[model samples]
Target: MKPAPFNYFAPESLKEAITLLERNHGTSKIIAGGQSLLPLMNMRLATPETLIDLRNIDGMKQIREVNGFLEIGAMVTHQRIMTSTLVQEKCPLLAEAAGHIAHRQVRNRGTIGGSVAHADPAAEFPTVVTALDADIKIEGPGGEHWLKPAEFFLGFMMTTLQPTDILTALRVPVSPPRCGWSVQELARKENFFAIAGAVCLLQLSQNRVVDVHLGIMGCSPAPLKPLQAEETIRGQELTDDLLAKVADLISEQVEPESDLHGTKAYRRAMAGVVTKRALKEAHHRASEGRQ
Candidate 1:
């Protein structure tokens, strides 16, 4: 299959991009990295009358820290994040998650904003951003706006972005001291989509769980933060029984669909197992922080 005929535009500035999108209205699709959109277009799953490429737009490729938040431009690639010392310093969880995305080739071309905009339920960026409570920056004819990850990701391959909007950057809070994080995912192959995945951020104070965030992916319509599990673990010591209970609760909360790769029951079970492992690793890291 081949993509349908389309007009292509590579705007040099965000303002120009917005103007192009507004002029095209709903007939155009924004292309950054083209990792997801190109594949969809080739398969005839997506057919936009106009394709607006964002690569030529400057300033969108920057990564900086401001006011304790890491500001990552939309054009920043997964491989860049995986290797960035600043990302590793301020947002180690995001760095670890970026290392899990597909393969080296995909990571070399996949943009952070593209992954977030693509909003695959099992994608690493969405799960990590959701756990970190990151804010998405968008610009359109109407002006700029910010959205929480929950507001940005509507469902599988869906987002709240308007046709005329451009995602410019993401602002994520720096991981605080006493925080430990881990990303656990299960895929048949190293670079394949995960059947189930867990992103865990644990904060410990004097051997007691002070705060925790558990983001579950590959087992729901969108990344799920299991508040029940987080609440259950808070103020408690990291124990095997407690971890088991949290894992079971997370499994119950996820809404996995049965597919060729795995059944709903299988995904649910794997989600639990992954959640347990993530919690254990997170606890270990947190303990290391104390020592």
Candidate 2:
């Protein structure tokens, strides 16, 4: 099905885009890459009267190192991120996650900002960003504001962004030395949404865990931070006993819902299994310093 009739505007600048959004008020939606929005539009789930295309905006597609973070423009394609040497060196977790986002065609057209703005509960980028403590930048008539990943996602398919706000970019801090990271998901086929997924980031000092961040998706309304579980690992040796305890803590924290993918019991059980496996693999990688 085709999308319903709507007035399309390709703004040349961010200011013009914000002005157009303000002029349209509640009747507009921003289109970047259209990888997710177009499908919703075709299904008649979203029928905005005005569509603001942001493709022509300059300076919104850059990927560079700014300060201590890797700043990625909202329009940077997934494929570009997957192949970028800088991203691979600085944030290999993001590159690995981007490589698994759908097929080549979809990745070539999908933008990181678009995915984050959509705030799909099952998407890899959102979970990874949340685990890494990334921040998102937004611009509107009110000027710019930054939101941490935890606060950025309010609920499934919803965010703190106003209708008039356009996500400008995402800022992710560079991983520290000996930082362990891993992402694991269970899908019937490659690139499909996971039945259960986990992303783990572990900071180690002298073979002991200094900090732990674990983010889970596809099992909750938004990415689950599982802070209680993280606290169980912090300042610990991450020995076999501690790992088991950490996994048990994570299982208790998650209240997964039953759906077409699996039962609540299955999801809850797998969440623990996946978390344990991901943490172990990440710890091994960090110890070996493997690419």
Candidate 3:
């Protein structure tokens, strides 16, 4: 199927894009990579009257360090992130997650902001960002605003962004010393949507967990940080017994729905299993670095 008729605008600058969005308001949609939007549009599920393409907008494709965070422009492609030396050295978790997104063709065309804006529940970037407590930078006619990861995602396929706002960048905190990370999911193919997934981060001190952040995907309306599960591992020595307890806590916190990929019970069971494995792997990585 072909997309519905729409007026296209390719702005040369960020200000012009904002102006176009402000003028069109509800009638317009921002097109970054169109990896997700085009599919929806082709199906007539999203029929915006206008498309404000950001491809020509300069400065939105940059990736650099600002203060203590790694700032990634909204238009930066998943392929860039997957291969970035800066990203790999600073936030290996994000790089790892990016490597797992779809296939090389999709990653080459999919932008970070596009995926976040699309807000797929099982996407890798969103889950990683939420677990890392990253911040989203958005621009509009009034100027810019920042939103915490927790506040950025409003619902499934929804966000806190206003109609006129454009996501400009994402700010992820640089990995601290002794930080460890892991991402695990089940898919029929190498790049298919996860049946159940877990992204875990642990900050350790003298073999004990100092900080814990665990986010789950493929089991909720939005990528979620299970606070109860995180609390279960905080300050504890990561051991087989402790990991088992934390896994049980995670299982109790999430109620996954039955779907075509797997039964609800199966998904729930996998969630616990994967969470434990992710934590264990991350802990081992941290231990190896320390040694």
Best by the TM-score measure = 1
**Tens-place lDDT digits, model 1, residues 1-291:** 889899999988889999999899999999999999999999989999999999888898999999999999999999999999999888788999999998899899999999999999999998988877899999999899999988888888889999999888999888888788899999999858889999888889999989888888899999888888888999999898998888789888999999999999999999999999888898889889931
Instruction: Give the range of the ten consecutive residues with the poorest summed lDDT in model 3.
Output: 282-291
By TM-score, rank the candidates, best first. 1, 2, 3
* lDDT for 223 (candidate 2): 81
Provide the overall lDDT of each model, using Cα atoms, as 2-decimal numbers. Answer: 0.91, 0.88, 0.88
TM-score of each: 0.97, 0.96, 0.96
Worst 10 residues of 2 by lDDT: 282-291
Candidate 3 lDDT over residue span 41-106, tens digit each: 999999999999999988989889889899999999999999999998888889889999999999
Candidate 1: stretches off by over 4 Å: none
Per-candidate RMSD vs. true structure? 1.3, 1.2, 1.4
Error of 1 at 52 (Å): 0.5
Residue 177 CA displacement from its true place in model 1, Å? 1.8
| Top lDDT hit | 1
